[model samples]
Target chain A: MRKLLPYPILSLSLLVLWLLLQQSLAIGQILLGAVIAVLAARAFAALEPQQPRARKLGSIFKLAALVIVDVMRSNLAVASIVLRDRHRQQTAGFVVMPLTLRDRSGLAILACIITATPGSAWLEYDSVRGTVLIHVLDLVDEATWVDTIKNRYERLLLEIFQ
Target chain B: MSEVPVWVAALVGGLSILGAAFTLLGCIGLARFNSFYARVHAPTLGTSLGSIAILLASAIYFTVSAQRPAVHEVLILVFISITTPVTLMLLARAALYRDRAESSGDVPLQWGEDIVVERADAPSEG
Candidate 1:
């Protein structure tokens, strides 16, 4: 089973995306989509990458919800800061936080979450030092940001990816 | 476009306008911020909430009118969500790298390169 489809999720999602793009589920479209998906999977398999095992699928949904809410909240906060708070004593600065999660996929997810938020951006991550440098546009509390990243996202990511 | 009802038209138009406004705000930040590092955040507004609102509008409009569950807009959403961050990260890394090459004091010197070699007595003075 693994031999035929090395990355089942990737293949399925690729097929779905192809179908969604075509916006038709005809027999020929299905066949062609399947072929393309399998080919893409095979091409990806050629890279011989480490397969990240999601230990807990339930946590993934929880994390997604958390991210959506955070994104919404931050969007409002950043917009207000940009439009009105520029003159105030607000400070934009860098934050370096220690990271415990080792999974590459988890780190990638973390980077995505940090960057997607309007005010915060992931500057760099040092795998050797296990630290990530982030920049905040309206930085008020450094410890709070660090705590949020560590507790809110990293903890759940560790549970899911580890 | 003419056959559509007023409310549906209003909803789609409203969403599209909101998305465009968000995108414009993102660009404003790009111009408003002083530094390159600070300006890097300008695109997130466009990518996240902007794309989301516009994509939702597209999906809602097509699904209601076409009467066949149009999800092609979702493809754009997924593509935008995945690619935006990666592009931002790469652009950031490149910008930081370029900035540091000029020996500017804003960015860290030892960033971007992997593997920080630490030794007991190997010139700790900076």
Candidate 2:
């Protein structure tokens, strides 16, 4: 049973995604999607990526709400900056911050969150040092940016993925 | 056009226009930013909320007019949301690698942190 469904959650989501793409709940489509999802799960298993464990499911919701709000706010901020021709006034630079979250999946999630936000780009991660290098646009203060990453995303990710 | 309801059509138009505006802003930022690192951030304006707005508009318009659940648009949303960051991440890393290899003064001379490269002998954790 374990071998057949090595990633039950992934398989289920992929199946739902497949059915959504099909845009139908017909019986035949459901069976076909299930088969395809199982196959995809096997392929993912073959790739041997690190398995991520979630310690707390509730934290996921909190993170999602936070990201949605942050993304919306930053989008408006960035759009206005571009419109006002203020891009030239601002300075952008790199800041590397130490991270305690060693889980690879947590780091990937952090990378997505940082890059998805308009002002910061996750440039590199140093696994040896548990630090990530990020490039910040409109970098008013380095300490502020570092503190935000640490307090906002890193702390939540550590709770969820670690 | 006559067959379509006015309010739904208006919603689609408004959302599309907003999406286009965001995309335009992001491109402008890309062009205007001072350096590569800074420019990397510019596209998020278009890809994140911008993509969401456009996709939502499309989903709403199609469902209301076609009289079928148009939630299939959610797949595009999921795909775009998942892939954009990966693509941007790769681009940023490639730029950093090139800069570091050339010893360019624009970026840090030494990143100082070491990432443990996955090796064949290492046990794969899943």
| Fnat: each model in turn | 0.59, 0.86
lDDT of 2 at B23: 89
Stretches of candidate 2 exceeding 4 Å from the true structure: B112-126
Per-residue lDDT of candidate 2, residues B42-71 (tens digit)? 888888877888999989888887888789
RMSD of 2: 6.7
| Candidate 2 per-residue lDDT over residues A1-162, each given as its tens digit | 999999999999999998998888999999999999999999999999877788887899999999999999999987776766653646778898898988888888999988888988888887876788888877889899999889999899999986
Model 2, residue pairs in steric clash: A51-B126, A127-B115
Model 1 has how many clashing residue pairs?
Answer: 0
Top candidate when judged by DockQ against the true structure: 2
For model 2, the docking class works out as: medium
Report how closely model 1 matches the true complex, as a DockQ value: 0.60
Candidate 1: list runs displaced more than 4 Å.
B111-126
The local lDDT score (0 to 100) that residue B72 gets in candidate 2 is: 83
Per-residue lDDT tens digits for candidate 1, residues A1-162, read 788898989999999988988889999999999999988999999999988888787889999999999988887776766686456624778888899999998999999989988888898888888998898887889999999889999999999998
